[model samples]
Structures are given as structure tokens and as C-alpha cells.
Target chain A: YREFYQCDVDVIGSKSQVNELELVQIVDKVFGLLDVNVLVKINNRKVLTGFAEICGFPDKVVDITVAIDKLDKIGLESVEEEMREKGLTDGAIAVIEQILKLSGSTSEKLASMRSLMNGGSASGLVSETGLKGLDELEELFGLIDAAGVKCPVEIDLSLARGLNYYTGAIFEVKAVDFQIGSICGGGRYDNLTGIFGLPDMSGVGISFGADRIYDVLKGLDKFPKSLASSTTLLFACMGAEELRYVLPVAAALRSEGVSVEVYPEPSKLKKQFDYAEKKSIPFLSINGGNEAEAGTIQLKNLTTGEQKSFSKADISGMKAFMNM
Target chain B: YREFYQCDVDVIGSKSQVNELELVQIVDKVFGLLDVNVLVKINNRKVLTGFAEICGFPDKVVDITVAIDKLDKIGLESVEEEMREKGLTDGAIAVIEQILKLSGSTSEKLASMRSLMNGGSASGLVSETGLKGLDELEELFGLIDAAGVKCPVEIDLSLARGLNYYTGAIFEVKAVDFQIGSICGGGRYDNLTGIFGLPDMSGVGISFGADRIYDVLKGLDKFPKSLASSTTLLFACMGAEELRYVLPVAAALRSEGVSVEVYPEPSKLKKQFDYAEKKSIPFLSINGGNEAEAGTIQLKNLTTGEQKSFSKADISGMKAFMNM
Candidate 1:
């Protein structure tokens, strides 16, 4: 099996707008450069918690949420069965089923939730957290709308990311064309630091699933050619002296932003050509005894088998030709 | 623990100067953009294989290699025991041990290996493939010399990446200041596609250990400041009608690349101010009936508690202020 690596950028110690904006902006810039279109969906746990409280399911909050979060994966029936198995009252399960089934524009869904909760002993149990959650949603959407970022920002209440530490906005980005699970996801966990004995600190961050993205990009053949290049030229030498003589010329080209490499051994020209062909190297520099003595180099195009001789002191045109 | 992502890019089919050069170039660009200095090391397995064959223990090649590969992790004693356990003769083990201890520049090490391997049953057994490896190494170094790339690239035989697929060049990059493991590493594997029924197709690749790099960057506080932004401004409203008036203006500023958010409720000004403070929003827009009708906004700087009035059309300046 192959293993990949990850790099997580996070903001901890505050749940302020600056922290959230900062994280999202970085996400935007990094992925933006990679030319991936992403839909960033955000939600808050307090909203879900409030929905639970208002549904007369205060005690079964975790159980109800944990099951409902799997709505997309296991479907509604399994979630309801899970709720029933978790000892939720029939009324509570019924309400949860209704909530889980609730879908519409985000505002419409919230409106429906509000109407459902506007009843019984659970009235107003959606309480401050849920109400604040609703307000936060409105504000967040307002911010997103106001930002006019090209990437779609959706308010997804059902996006109950499985983690227990999320307190405020939870974010996940999905590529429009790929579906190997989320390409990037993260959230604001207000109490993660509490585990380390530092309470009440909040943090938000995202992890880009690099391996999966790589697979996705590779499968789609989306890697930019520029990202895969090593060198633009290779020097095929016939001897150590030739290699030594041509080193400075290659060095000068390299200093001028051309990537140059010289073959170390004085091997057969065909063998050197084989090496160049296999690595996808585009250009080959041939500087045998004659070329060395004349202070000239023959640049051969590995791809097209084209060759041109260049004076040692002036190879700018050759550099451009090699780049192509 | 936080997780980042990693991707390994490999190219197989040819072990030439082009392939090795491409490897180094890709390494330079990616790591260069990331502002990470890496030590790219190259090694040839053919040399090691030559040592194994000339040691009179050709059958124990894999065992010898596997043991020696663990030298950095478990030390020489463990490798010796591993060879002993694999039934290598004492004489062969001594020969292998002597070759393993070869030190100095790469050519010097190669010289020593050749000296030890000469006059044995395996004499001249290290022919074309082995010689080709040395030639490849020289070509690789020649290319690197020619390129004059700023990143440090070295040749070390001890870096036997634990795999048999490598037919030509192998590479590993280690970050100097980080306490973590190899930040990046990969090599040319000639037979990777052989498992997929495409033998002899050589491929070279490198993988960046993004997660470890992220940890190191985070630990070093190397993240740029702009990455942590959330909303640029919070539009505090006097009432529902006031919010309606602010929406279009918010949208306009958003269109101009400013992240603007509006309060959902007509909360007290103090409460709104506290919210702005909590969110770390630097600017707040307060639209009273007068300002709303006048098509102007009263902008309050939360950090300095400074207020300024701007006409609706003048909001594009927010983008410049934030990005600049």
C-alpha cells in the first residue's frame, strides 16, 4: 500500500471573524491556485443541538444527531431505526424523522424547524444556542453573500461533521467533479484545547486530502505540466573531460533560469539518448571533443530529435528553444 | 492530531538524465513556492547489488539489503545478525561488512566497493548494469552541476530507499530545521507498472510529506498573516428596514472583493458591538434611518473605535484596504 502526507493549517485560541476568515482565505488561495472549484459548506453544532432540544429530545441529543448525521450514507430508514434502537421516545423519534426529512432552501428549512419547535413543553427549548445558531447562519450567509467569492458557499444544517469538539462553524469543501469523499474538511472546535488542559480556547482549521486529490487529479489528468517538470535540458557527454568542459556553459544557462544537467559518464550517444527519452527530459546537450575544442555545443531535442549548434558564450536563443 | 495531505508523483519508463532532471526541477518549484529548503539526495542501488553479488552471497541479496537498509534505525549489529540469521557465510559477511563501511566522496566509495569486489567469484559480474548505474549517477550530478539550482543536492550510497522497483535514480529530501522525518522522498522505479502487467516501464517520482511540513511550519509560526481573515466588516442594523437597506450595499462591497456581514437581528448597538468584537471584525457598518436614506454608511473601526462616513459608491476602497 502507498502512504501520502498531509499539511494542516489551523487557527486556535479564538472564534473571531478574523480567525475564520483567515483560514477560509488561505483555503481559497491555495486551492484557487491549483484551479479546483470547491463548494464550502458550513454549519454549527449549536444549531443542531438547539434543534434537538426543541424537538423534545434533549436527553437523546447525541444519539439522535449521531444517527441523523449518517442520513446521506445509511438513508432515512436506517437513521430512524437507529433512533428507535437508541431508546428515543416515539414522539421524539417522530419529530426527529420529520426534522431529518426536512429539506429546502436553508431559510425554508429553518422556518420549518422553527414552526415544528413552536409547540409543547419543548417550546423555546431551542433556547439561546439554537437561536444564536440561527442568527449565526443568517450572518454567515450574509457574510458569504456579501463577499461575492466565486466559490459557492452553502449553509448546510445537515452537515454534522462526526467530530464531538465542533462548537461553531464547521466547514467542508467538495470538488465539483470528484467524489472520493471530501477533498478538504475542517471545523471550529471550541474545546479541543481543553483536552490539553487549556479550556475554552476555540480553533478552526482545514485538512486537504492530498493523496485523494492527487488520485483524483491524476485520474482526471488534471496535473499542470509545469508541476511535473524536473529539468529542461540534459547534457550527454562522451568523456569526463567533456563533462568538465561543458559544466560552466550549463551552469550559465541554469543561472539564467534554464534547468541543465550533464551526463556523468562518457557513454555511447545512444545510451545517453535512451536515458533522456525515459525521463521525459526534453533537451540533450552534446559536447564531445570536437564541440568542446570549438567552444560550441549541439543541443538536441529529445522529443523531436532536432539539433542545433550554439556558440558557448551565447546560448540565450538555445535556452528559449530548449524550453519549448 | 491535525492531519494534512500528501501526494506522490511518479514517472516510470526511462532512467535518463531527463527523468532525473525532471525530478529535481519539480522538487525545486514545489518546495520553492512553499519556501522550504530541502536536501535532495540521490543514490544507486546497483552499487549495493554489486557489493552483494561480489560478496559470494548472491542468494542473500534481499536479506542483505533489507538488513543494511535498517542500519540507520537499528545499527550495524542488527544488520550483522540479520545477515547471520539469513545464513550468510562468515567470509561473505566480512566482505559485505567491509564494503558497507566504504566512506568518502561518492567516487571514493565506489572505488572502495570495486576494490573489495575485485578478485572474487563475482569479479566483473558488476558489469553494464552496475557501470550504467555509476554512469547514471555521474550524469545526474553533471545535470545538477549544470542546473546550478539553489537547493542542495547530494549523492550518498547509504540512502537505499527500501524497495526493489528502483532501476536507476532514487531521491529523498529532508528538511534541515524540522524535527520530523523526511519531508519529501521518491525515486525511479523501473518495474512499478510491471505489477500492473507493464514491465520495463521505468518511472521516477517524489512525494512531499505535507503533513509533517505543515506541523513544522505551524511549530515555526511560518504561516503568513493574511491566511486568518474571516469577515471584513459587520453591518450593524437599527431595525429590519435598516437591514434591508444595508443588504444591497453589503452586496456591492462583496462584489468588490470585501467580506461583509450584516447582523440578522436588530439587537442593541452595544450587543452588536460586542458581537463585532467577538468575531474580531475590524470594521462595523452602522446604518441608521438617516444614513440609510442618504445612501451612506457610518464605518466604525472596532480596533481603534474610530468612525468614518463613506458614500455607498465609495465602498470599493474596502477591498484595497484589506488586501493591501
Candidate 2:
């Protein structure tokens, strides 16, 4: 199926052996770091199959499902027209439309579907496969509750992911505040590996569209400011001799987990200071002939205009001065 | 030109305006961090052109250079055959072969080439364009020495990069210990952006092939072991209730810069331990019903088999324990 995010499966097994509850938990844990509100909408292909069978158009399942999948993009009128062109009777089209309009809290929707399946006029309409799909979704929701997933999990019957291979729960994640398509999507597929001569294997997966997520974060100004500067301190030298003296000190600071750089080529002091300023380097250390002989460095705080000399041995003090 | 690494130029200006000295300094500084021995080999297209002119076939410059570029891959006999096919006479081909065989220290090679250009009745045969190329190389070497670049710089006459666009210095970096092709390569292009409506823009750059460097580092076992694990601590809870209790604690640890994850779903203790072991998570914090009620967690060091109980206020202590 086409999706914005690249998909990767967590577990692969037969359709009946796919662990729906564990999948929900895994998704919940995976998305736990997001500060913004998110919704995980789930649906099942079997539900669509049962609905088509009950509507007396089981042979036209793929066509009906394909039309319904484009509902959001093409609207109800176009979907109905497409289904009609596929030879679906108006009555079967009406039944599919009613199911698409089903909505409520996850449990409330499940309850509504159950009543529709068992009510006198509608009784025996939903196939056993449809009931099994509803049961699987109910178990998934129950486990999600038990696991205390922070994100909302909704049973969106209208979310018919456009893929004929999906056999069980399909998941689509969307940001609550962002007006965009799904940031993540995936579903369970049966016998995917069977095409490669490994039979009966099923799999389920979800993937986050990293580029879209980055765009969203950028639009929201959520990126931390400190990420811009890789160098915490820059050593400004007066000449090649000073550079030679400062190289080892810079290397030692790097070894102590401090990101440091030595100004190559003894340029003008103003140019070196400008370089430090543009790079957002807070601390600038100068080891001229005097400092080099004394085994000390003159450290300047670009933000504060404060300067001090620290002995070469006091790396921790220098680190504290730089607030690294 | 196609290259293994993605090339990016630091300085761009007209051919005559671009400062070649600054380019050498920039390259020297950029590669200063590499601990392994590296050689920066330099050549010039103008020198190749001048050599072709002095050999009495200026119009065959491209053809002769193309043939010689394959010298390392196809050997001297094949290069001669290709040059012959390109219509270079035996005498001119002999001269080009002699130049290709010229080898020594960088300065010694320059001395030999200078004498070749002015020594015999063939003296003054080398054009001023070729002499200018020699002069640029001499200036680049002078600056490299003055800048005290740690890497060895070499001038090889046979180092003819196949690209016809290079107007000045061409560089290729080779790791001394590695058997792969050049890890980095680039050259000065006279009017690279001119084709895009920006005329006379000369640019010089070199690019490090990150994938090749990574492969070399991997083969040498130079990658740090700590890169394998992202999580420093994992909390293994007994049930959903304990999981809820551990979630906030894990978040707090994460806020303090300790990579932490809570075992989702409160799986079996053995399974949780196995996950921590496989992921190389050094610390496992357990907060079951009793520990949850006591507002403390029993943190175990998976590697050292040390266990200790810490209260909620002891996050700083746990940070120390994790060495994060």
C-alpha cells in the first residue's frame, strides 16, 4: 500500500497468529515521546469483507473497498458514482455508506456495530468474519487501556486503507494540531513472504514520515537552539607556534567530551572573533606567545565581554567557564 | 564530475580572484582531526595542457590526458596504444611517457620537471601556461608548509584527474593504511557556475567519501563500542500499575539526559532482562507493587550484578550510577 512513511514490521507470523494487543502496545510505546496530541485510527479489512457479503455483493468486494478508500479525497457523491459504475446496487451502496458514517468513542462505535449486526432486521447480515474483526479490535482497545497509552485510539470504520493484502487491523496516525495527511500508517498483511517461497507468514508495521515530522516541528519552532553549535569552544592563536601549543590543549578538551576547534592559520583577531560569533561559540580561548610560554590560556566570554586566564591543567575550570 | 564523495566548495569567485592559498588552509584544518596518515596529492590541468603543447600536439590535449588518466588501470602499453589511436606520433608519446614516469619527493619532482622544461635544445618548448601551473604548485606547497599542515602533501606528475573542467590544482586524498581508492577527491573548476548564468565563478573543493570512510573504519575496528546502545537504562515493571508508576520516573531520567525506556506491557521478568541484555542496557530499575508503594525503585546493574534501592529524590544518584 502507498503511504507517506516507510513501513517496517515488528512481528511476522500467520494472519491468525498476529498479536493485535502487542502491536497496539508497541505503537503506544513508540509514540510516547511526542509532546503533541496524536490519534491512532484502526480498522480491519475483514470488517469490509463481511459488510460486502452482508450487502449481497461479496464478488465486488475489491471494487467497493477501492471506492470507499477514496471517500475522503473524492467525497461521498464520487464514491457512490464509482461503486455504481462497478455494478454495486443502490441498496448495497446505501449499506456501505451507513457503515462509513459510524462514529463515536472506540467502545461506543464497537457497541453500535454489534447492535447493528444482531438487530432483528439486520440480524445475520454481518458474517462471522466481521464479528471476529470487531472482537479483535475490542481486544486491542482493552489492551491499550490496560497499557495506559497516552494517545487516543479510535475505531474509525471509514479508514479503509487502499490495499487488498491487508487481512487484519490497519493503523494510521495523525497529528491532532497539524492539518496534513497521516504521519504514520501500516497494517497486517497475510502471506507476504509466501510470494518469496516462504508460505503462511503475516506481518504488521508502522513508520513515521521523518521529513514531514521535521517540517511540522520546524513550523512549530520546536527545535532546540543549542543544536546549531557543534563547537563549544574555539581557540584563537596568533601564529603557527601558538597554534602548535594550542593543538594539544584542544585535543585534550575533545578527549574530555568537549567539542573544540582551533582557528587554523593565524588570521586577524577581529576575523577570528567574528568567526566565533557567527558560529555561536560562547567561549574563545587565546594562546599567544605569552600564554603559550606561561602554559595558560586567556578565555573570553563572547556574550559577557569577560576575560580570564586559566592554567592549562584546569580543564574542568575551563569547562565550567564555558558552561559546557 | 562524478565522484564517490559529495563535493562542496568553501570559496567561490572568478578564476583569477579565488585565493588558492586559503583553499589549502581550509582543507588542512578540515582534515586535522584524522589520526591516520593521509597524503594530499596535487596536479593541474593546465600543466597537462602545456605538456601536450610542448610535445607538439596541443589539439590532442584532451585525448592524450584521457588516455594517461587510465594509466594506473590499463598500464603503460595500453596508454601508448590509446594515444597512438588518438594520432600521437612515437616521439611525442615517448615524451609524455617520460613525464608520467617522473617520481620523487614533491620538491624533487618539481625540480626535475623545471629542468625538463628548460634543459636541452628542447628548452623553451614548455609553454608559459605549463610554467604557470608549476608556479601555482610551488605557491601551494609554500603555504601548506607555512600553515604547518600535519598531513603529508605530495606532487605526482601522473596524477591526471580525467575531468577537463579543472583549470588549476586538483587534489586526491588517500588513507595510508587503506587499500580502497582515494577516500576524497576534488579540483578547481574555472567556470563551474558560468553554465548556470553565473559567469567566471571559479570554485575549489574536496569531499570525503563518508561511506568508504565508514567501511574503512569498520574494517579497522575503529568504531567506538558505545555506539551500539542508545538506551542506558530500562525499567522492568511487574504489571500495568507498576508500569504507570515507572513511566514518570523514566521520563524524569530522560529529561536529565539519561536514555531510558520502560518495559511496555509488564512482560515476564526474564523476557525483560533478556531485552536489556540484548540491547546492552547496563541498568534495570524494578518498581513492583511494594516498591511503588514505598516510592522507591530497586536498580540493578545488569553487567556488574549490583543492586541498590533508590528513592524518587535519588534521580541524581541514578544518573551517576548510569554515568550519564
Q: Specify the highest-TM-score model's number.
A: 2
Cα lDDT tens digits, model 1, B10-128, are 65554555556767877876677667767788887775666567766666657777777788889887888888899987777777677667678756765565555554332344434
- Per-model DockQ against the true two-chain complex: 0.10, 0.06
lDDT of 2 by residue, A1-324 (tens): 244445454567524222454455455655565455678888887777777777778877788778877888899899999999999888877777777777777788787776555431132465777777778777667656644556778876666666577888888888777777777777888777789997877776666677776666676566667787888898885875676667666756766788887675567899989999999988899877888789897888888999989998788888888886
DockQ leader: 1
Off by over 4 Å in 1: A1-4, A114-125, A293-295, B1-324
How many clashes does the backbone of model 2 have? 1
Model 1 residue B256 distance off true place after TM-score fit, in angstroms: 13
Number of the top-ranking candidate, with lDDT as the measure = 2
**What lDDT would each prediction earn against the true structure?**
0.71, 0.72
